[model samples]
Target: MYILLALISAIFAAIYFYYKQSFTYWQSRGVPHLTPSMPFGNLNKPWSIPLVDQVTKQYKIFKKRGERQAGFYLMTEPIYIPIDPEFVKNVMIKDFHHFTDRGLYVNDEAQPVIGNLFFSDGQKWKNLRQKLTPTFTSGKMKMMFNTMMNCTVPLQESIGQIADNNETFDAKDVMSKYTTDVIGSCAFGIECNSFKDPDSDFRKYGRLMFEENAIKAMKFLFSLSFGNLAKKIGLKNMEPEVAEFFTKVAVDTYNYRIKNNVKRNDFMQLLIDMMDKDNNGGQKSNFLTMNDFVAQVILFFVAGFDTSSVTLSFTLFTLASHQDIQGKLRQEIKNVLKKYNGEITYDALQEMKYMEQVINETMRLYPIAPVLGRVCTQNYTMPSTNLVIEKGTKVFIPNWGLQRDPDYFPDPDKFDPERFSDENKGSIDPGTYLPFGEGPRICIGLRFAMMQMKMCLAALLKDYEFRMNPKTIVPLQLGFGFVISVKGGIWLNVKRIS
Candidate 1:
């Protein structure tokens, strides 16, 4: 018993000493840092709050300390958060080569889902990004516009039913179903019919993909704290079930498309064509395997659907909350549609300048990705500072904190779309307003996502008026998850225009 106790004591002592050394990393380097708690590092409880909120809180703390750059430990790992816009510009653009990889938890061999463009790093990400960039261009989007518009037919009809019943519904769920159907048709070349059948597998699996239960949440936190160790133990970035479901769906879809000799002007077709070329030994500038194809499709479906749905839902919620703004936006949509003969087209969608401003403002208040992360690819010295960020150091750009800063955006809490008006937009700083991020590694699907949101908003606003539902919690409390989602959903009541 004494021998066992001694061994246990030695193990604990080693761990404690190691953590002490690790926690002193930023301090030794002459960097301001948040004082870290033992075992959990800077976080008192690793899972105490939602990840988004935690990062935002840290951003506020570091900003209030009057520091341009500060460091904090997630467990033993040091993460650098840059508060200055100049520093953000350097990291995102000028010195981007030194900060290429997102430093996300990705283990393709262990979890194929992480092989997607979002998580993959180094040359793989570059190649995949180059290959997929053209897939979302204006011409490509125009080709897929009809398919996306078709999905909105069901969206309008379903929302019309709710308006008829005079019942409040979860706008998030409703918007998600519309996006699910859009992604199903556009990304996978299949009909989801989610509006007609809410329990469709596409909707179920998509919801499950984003669902953050306790166990999965803990695992995600663990991975963030101990990435190398987590990867060693084969800890997946996605839930096992989510990874499995998406992988299967990707594979089945690919096989079906190839077997049927299917070709459609959508994301899935582009991926399939790439795979076909590789199989046929055609010109191989950037050949894609079946796995790569599936990964890109899944990335498009997951990232595009969730973020856009949340954006659309929040736009509606905010519009409902402020009836005057909603009226103004609805009027703009009405005027734009009249020019195109009551038809919502890509051209008409773009003409709703005020609606675009509303989305911009909505995103500023509740940016889909509250914090963006990058890992140092090589040792980088700040241009004007003595601080040297070591290779492998994780860097965070606090999207929420920066966008909500009163200095950049006066009266930040107020939902004011004029802040994004053409006259006012030019006054905003270059790097201060990155709803879709900045630089080469910026979101490739920005055009597609904007197109999706515009069409849905235009269609909905043209026919129906919305107000906040009583079931919703006002002065909204955000969910503490990867994305900025409202807790208990953004409930809204709809009324059909006579």
Candidate 2:
């Protein structure tokens, strides 16, 4: 027993000394950093505190100290944080080549769908991005507009029923179902009818993707910290059930379309065209494989539904809290639709400038992706600084902090859409407002997401009035996860507009 105890003690001592040495990396490099603790580094109470909150907190501390950049550690792995907007611009846009990859764990063999545009790196990402760019073009968005509009029909009806029944409902849940239906119709060429059947497979699997447990969280951390080892052990980025369900859906959709010669204007059709080498005349050497097609499909489904749903839900919550802004937005929607003869057309949706302002403000306050992560592809010196960020160093842009900073946004916490108005928006600094990110790697689905959100808001705000329900927790405590989410959900009461 004594021998075993001594051996264990020696091992723990070695680990302690190693961590102590690793923690000095920032200090040795003459960079400012927060003190790190054992095992988790600077990440304190990671399981309890949301990463966005932690990053934002660190950003505030460093920014307050007038530091342009700071360094920290995530489990002995050194991370660089850019606190200055100029630095942020350099990392995201000006010197984007140096930070092309998001540094996320991707194990295609173990989880085929994990090897997606959002998670891919190097030449693969560049090539895939080139091919996928046209997929989200303005023309494609125009093509998919009608299909997206069709999904909103169920959304309006479901919300109208809740309004008539005088019931309090979770706005996030409602918006999620609406976006799920939209993504389902647009991405998979299938009707999810999420409002009609809340337990639909699409909805079930979508929820499973975001549902966090201790095991899921630990697995995520492990994959992030020790990616190679995790890959060797066959760790998955998502639940096996989710991966299987989405993969099967992709295959089934592809086979059915090919067998029947059915072609639609949605995303699936475009992917099918790219994947079918025979259709491509067998000339394109870089044509998409079955795995590639499914990966992209899953990416679209996940990014499309979650980001838009979060934005829509938060916008509703914000508008519900501030009736004046809501009223003004409703008037704008009414005016735009009036011009189009009460029909929500693509062009008409674009005319609702106030509606756009509302959405932007909500995004600024509660971004779907609170922190933007990138990896240093090569050793590069930060412009105007002596510090050299080594290759493979993980960098984080505290988007939540930057958006909520009082320096750029006066009275930052106030839910004011006027900040995003044409008159005031120009004064905002670059790199500070990154709801869709910036530069080449910015969200490819920006136009699609905006259209879907605008359509939903215009449809609902035209006829229904939403008010905050008392059941919603005040001050909005955020849950610990990758996406920004409310702890108990955003509850609201709906009433028909007279």
Candidate 3:
């Protein structure tokens, strides 16, 4: 009886202390906020809520306080959100070294897949980034252009098949198959033919990585809000099978290429070249191990597959919603391709400025990762506010919310490529646009994703007109997973054009 009474007393004491600590966060600074609940701080019931919905809720709370920035807790861990773009830029770019890490690190000893480029930090990331930059250069991309286009032959034919069948098809699913083939061929140096085989290995694992499931959703939320705690609890951001299969594919491919004197123009060859160059472990060219080689290859496949798939889906979504814009875009494609004698070339893609604007706008609204995170390594003060943020704090750059904020973007939801036009693009602040993030750690695969997207769009627009099907879930809800993904899928119908 005394033991039970002691346990109840301990629980009450913990809750009371949590409330006191949470309330003191804003009160001590003379900032205003709603009273926070015990233990959970201001986020008492966020466990089951969708990420977008949670951000929207937090946004409303931040706006209500009328402060440029405010402190909140993700389960007693203090995190700061900068309501001003200037402050956000300061944290992300202007004074970046102090806040270089993304606040989320996985122990490679336990989880090798989690230790790849998107998650590694410090000198390891710097060295890896330097050694791999050449892989994405315009020269190297030129070498792989044919490999990328090789996937499009299947995509173009598949779209034609659907239009001929006269049945409405989900653009997301169709585009997923297309992108799966593109990444499979380019990254793995294998022909997946996702278009021909719906159960392609790449397609299967791609779905596993991003599908809305309880384990994945909870893992992501906890990882973002409470990194150490999540790690301690053994939460994972990816499926174990994904890592095993991709690693095996990369290792076997590299070994096969070495044994048979195989040479290809895709990303795998570049990995091989980088490994050969960086044997001595210099800062510019560090030692690349067998795992490092496979990690890069696997990361290339994992990162490229879903993001390109989603971007293609959003590209189709925006095009379908704006018929006039679609007509304008199609006309540009027709004119551009005609100049090339109906062959899509690297030179021609660069000339498609309107298509660039369209893609930029799609990324603007439906960024692949709607949220970004940074961890505080040391105490840093905000230049504008002089508010000292202590070490061990987490920060969230709400790319999803900030992009949609009307204060910065008028009629923010409208799909207007002209907003990114040369005339007006220079006028808007650069950091305000962070679809690919900013400063040192922005996405390394941006160039590849853009090339793949542009080629797919060009091939389709040159051939068909797409419209939204009633079957598509409108105002697309995000899939409940680590990456910013849409739920219920994006469906559309295509009309063949002469």
Candidate 4:
């Protein structure tokens, strides 16, 4: 018994000494840093708090100190959070090559279908990104616009039903259904009809992807901090069922398209073409395998589904809370549609500039992708500093912090769409706004996402009015997890704009 206790004590002592050395990494490099604790780096009870909250808190602290950039740790791994917009631009755009990869751990063996453009790194990412770039082009988006417009039929009808019944509905849940149907049709070339049947397979699986799982979150953090070690232990960020389901759907769709000689002007059809390109007298080397093809489609659906939904829901919430802004948005939508003979066409949607400003303000306040992560791909010196950011160092740009900082955005908490108006928007500095990120790694589907959001918002605002439900908690308490979700969902009462 005495010998066992001594052995345990010795092992702990060794671990303590090792980590103690790691704590001084930033200080040794002459970089300003937050004080770290023994095991969890600078964080105390990190697991007990949401990463978004933690990052935002740290961002406030660093900003208050006027730090251009500050180093901190997540476990033993050092992370550099850049408070300066100049540094942010340098990492995101000016010096993009040095930070090309997001440094995410992919258990390809476990979740092979997850190696999409979003999570892929190095040459693989570059190759995939190059091929996928044309897929989201304006011409391609124009081709898929009709398909997306068809999906909104159920969205409007469902809202009409809700408004007639005078029943309060969860805006997130409602908008998620709309997004699911849109993505299902556009990306997978299927009819999800989530609005008609909320328990549809697409909706069910989509909800599972974002549902808060403590074990999953911990594993994700562990993988991010110690990627090599996590890989050795076979840590996977994607749920097994999710990977399996998406893989099956992708394979079945691909096989069906080939067998029936079917073709559609949707995202899945583009992927199908890429896979069948060799047979269609195209380059074999540029082609994606079944796994690669499926991965991109899944990413398109998953990433676009949740993000667009959250943005739409939050935009409604903002509009609901501020009636005057909502009224202006409705007027813009009404005028634009009248010009196009009441048709919500792509060109007409673009003319709704005030609507765009509203969405921008909503994104600023409740960016679903709260933090932008980048991993240094090479050793590079930060401008005006002797600090050499070593290769493979993870860098975080706290969008949540920068968007809300009083220094950059005066009256940051106020939901003023005028802040994004033509007259006022130029006053805002670049790099301070990155709801969809920037540069080459910028979201390929930005135009499509904006169109979908604008379509939904314009349709609803033109027909109905949204007001905050009594069930909705005041001040909007954020849910614990990665995404900046409202806790218990945002409930809202709907009324027809008669």
lDDT of 1 by residue, 246-270 (tens): 7788788778877887778788888
User: Model 2: residues >4 Å from true position, as ranges?
Assistant: 1-6, 277-287
Query: RMSDs, each prediction?
Result: 1.5, 1.5, 2.2, 1.4
lDDT of model number 4: 0.87
How do the residues 328-401 of candidate 2 rate in per-residue lDDT, one tens digit apiece? 99988888888899999999988989999999999999888889999999999998999999999999999999
Count of clashing pairs, candidate 4: 0
- Per-residue CA lDDT of model 4 for 62-164, tens digit only, reads 7888778888889888888888999999999999999999877777777778888999888988888888888998899889989999988999999999999
- Cα displacement (angstroms), candidate 3, residue 211, comes to 1.7
Give the TM-score comparing model 1 with the true structure, all chains together.
Answer: 0.97
Compared with the true structure, all predictions reach lDDT values of 0.85, 0.90, 0.79, 0.87
Question: Which regions of candidate 3 deviate over 4 angstroms?
Answer: 15-19, 29-34, 60-66, 280-287
lDDT tens digits, residues 288-310, model 3? Answer: 57877877787888788878887
| Candidate 3's TM-score | 0.94
Candidate number with greatest lDDT: 2
Q: Any residue pairs clashing in model 2, and if so which?
A: none
